[model samples]
Target: MKKTLLALLCAFITSAASAQSVSTVVHPEWSKNAAIYEANIRQYSPEGSFKKFEEYLPELKKMGVGVIWIMPINPIGKVNRKGTLGSYYAVADYTAVNPEFGTPEDFHHLVNAIHAQGMKVIIDWVANHTAWDHPWAKTHPEYYIHDAKGNFVPPVPDWADVIKLDYGNAQLRSEMINALKYWISNYDLDGFRCDVAAMVPTDFWNDARTQLDQIKPVFMLAEATERDLQEHAFDMTYGWQFKDVWGDIAKGKKNAADLVAYLHGEEAGYNPNSYRMLHTSNHDLNSWEGTEFDRLGDAVETFLVLSNTLKGMPLLYQGQEAGNTKALDFFERDPIIWKDHPYRALYTKLFHLKQTNHALWNGLAGGQPQLIKTADDDHIFAFSRSKDNDQIIGIFNLSDKARKFSSNDPILQGSFTDPLTGQSGQSASAPIELKAWEYRLLVK
Candidate 1:
């Protein structure tokens, strides 16, 4: 009986190995209902270590942050580096954890902590380039992109800090795949958010997705807005064009009517399951363009209202919920000063409402957004989201002054309570009044 049991155990192990060795394109169960949270390790906390950030798993879980997308944790290359510590994208070693962040054991602890909170962790991946001091740069020089003079060049003309990778080499592809597998199998990483995905070849990503799915279920988010990148690989793509349009409208360079044409283009250009990440602020905007306060101006609240009600996954960047006013330096050591603020209360209420509103969910599972035709459509934006008996009506004043807007849209003619306050409102034949930057969220 002992001999028979040993044989059965050996067979089970072999079967499991074979299953993991085979690649697939389908994702497993952990990612479907998940919400993504961005973790900027350097600026997230005072210590900026994996150990330090691990303390927030419970709070994140409480706040409904389902998937934790950690910024790059690899050793920052120093040779021709940009800042004191160098860019995280300029990786010195893909296989090892950055000593500045923590040890490999610390990372394991962090991943375990996130998992213990019933959350998933997908890390940021920059596979298109590497730091000049990367070992592969010296040992396998041919793997890098060479210029006319046979010298390795950066990915873009202005990217003087890092070296570009050559994708035409099959050996490089195999090595990258192995590195990815090592992380997934050894650390239990849930998925990846690929940086500048449009710069990389599509076939490589498709292969990577297939290889990753074999080990476990994974979620893939691409930084590119290209439609063909979706295929069987990525679950979501950046809504960059929409974000640019928002910037234009805020600057008075474009009108709110532009959103209609953009949405129509997206509906026809992308896949049905192709999730678009909608955000008010991200790393680039906070670091490069100013904070949401500067970019959105008095229209901030109105834009935030539309961001959640739109047909996409809403993103809350770090410090955004705290009314972050400082412009974070991208290449240096800057910690977000976590403090008591009004934006927290506003976000807490808004997030709570978003969670409970079935009509405001993402994609086909959510209701269609219908704009409420208003008299002052330029300054006052009114819209409604409806799915069956469930509906949410929103009205916001984007201009600098208080405004009264008349909307005759039947969708906005419902009786509902403003969950932000306990007051109930039943619309009549008259127009609704709103103060500058003030917004209303009502549900029926």
Candidate 2:
């Protein structure tokens, strides 16, 4: 009897182990090495229309952008609106496109055009809340949360334009899921970039993901950094902690050691298969906080390189390639002034490297970063990521002063080429010199 009980216990443990080994969230095959670009349609062009933005498809493709995450296309709520145009987060309708951007047909054409260019497109989904004027607010009031006086309230005190949703209502969940399916079934959308995903219930996301996958494999990106979101709901989550660390380093408040510590912490906290979206600037940062130039200053390019070569997926915001310096107005129409900038070339090179090099691919598809110890560990951040035959060693001077560092690691002594400069040379045991905020990438 004791022997039989031991055998049963062993069987149960083996089954549990096998279950834990398998990831619940399966990432789409196309997203394995893809870099995501945030397309802010409202500020992308002077016209701010889908047709106008479609003209840039070839250019974006040339830049090696794989996934284009377009901002919310739903109509804005006019009641209690913040400005003349109102916030994009305040969705007036889920199924209809905002007439200001273009007609629904125009959006359909844009999605088709993006796919034609061999790129995937994902639209922003605001599921946690809806505009105060949303039809459901009146017809199905139970879909929303109410105050003590039976009045609808915003998710937060500051966001008065939008009202919070009640996931406790099962009917609301079904309707919301149905609305999500409508886009996939009608427009053939690849996936969604869920807004404030953490605020909503996790089970809803899991159910939605399962249903969406039944139609087709979808890529889901959450706007939050919560690790649990990646377990079964999202393919990727925002790496806000890394962004904060990068900003602190630029402000002289942190150093290379701090950056290394953060990376180690991230590896320990999050699942290895989960993709984290790394970016120097996004729509929120560019419009609310500041542009990359404002926050990162001279270290802008350095951090950009780090974001791309790090162990996660990199995000390039619209206008970042053009080096737009102004803080775009959030509530009004502020067009990005396109110009010839070095940033475009730099991004092109880094993105191409990310595409061709398996070491820089997204999530588990890429290699884990191994620190290459250097003499100046405080200012010089050096690491190597290798997958099979492909390898990349990144050396960055994270401070303002010049740095001279030498690494005795055997991986550093090899014939490599710089993807950015197209220069080929052999790295010896000799000390390497780098200017303030300079970064070097060696590919083998």
Tens-digit per-residue lDDT, 1-444, candidate 1: 969965865665455434321122344455433456788888887688998889877777777776788989889988888878777788888899999888999999999999889888989888899888899998999889998999999998777778999999999998988888889999999988898999989899989988988898788889998767777678788988877877777777766455544554444456445677888888878888888889888777678766766767777788876778888888888999888776666666666566667676654556766777688866676677876567887776656678887866666655688777768876623587888766777888
Give the poorly placed runs of model 2, Cα more than 4 Å off.
Answer: 1-22
**TM-score of decoy 2:** 0.94
RMSD to truth, every model: 13.2, 6.9
Model 1 residue 61 distance off true place after TM-score fit, in angstroms? 2.4
TM-score of each candidate structure, all chains considered together: 0.88, 0.94
For model 2, give the 10-residue run with minimal summed lDDT: 14-23
Candidate 1 TM-score, true structure as reference: 0.88
True lDDT of residue 285, candidate 2: 95
- Mind giving the per-residue lDDT tens digits that candidate 2 earns over 195-310? 99999998999999999999999999999988788888899999999889999999999999888766654444677798989999999999889999999999999999999998
Residue 104's lDDT within candidate 1 is 98
**Global Cα lDDT for candidate 1:** 0.77
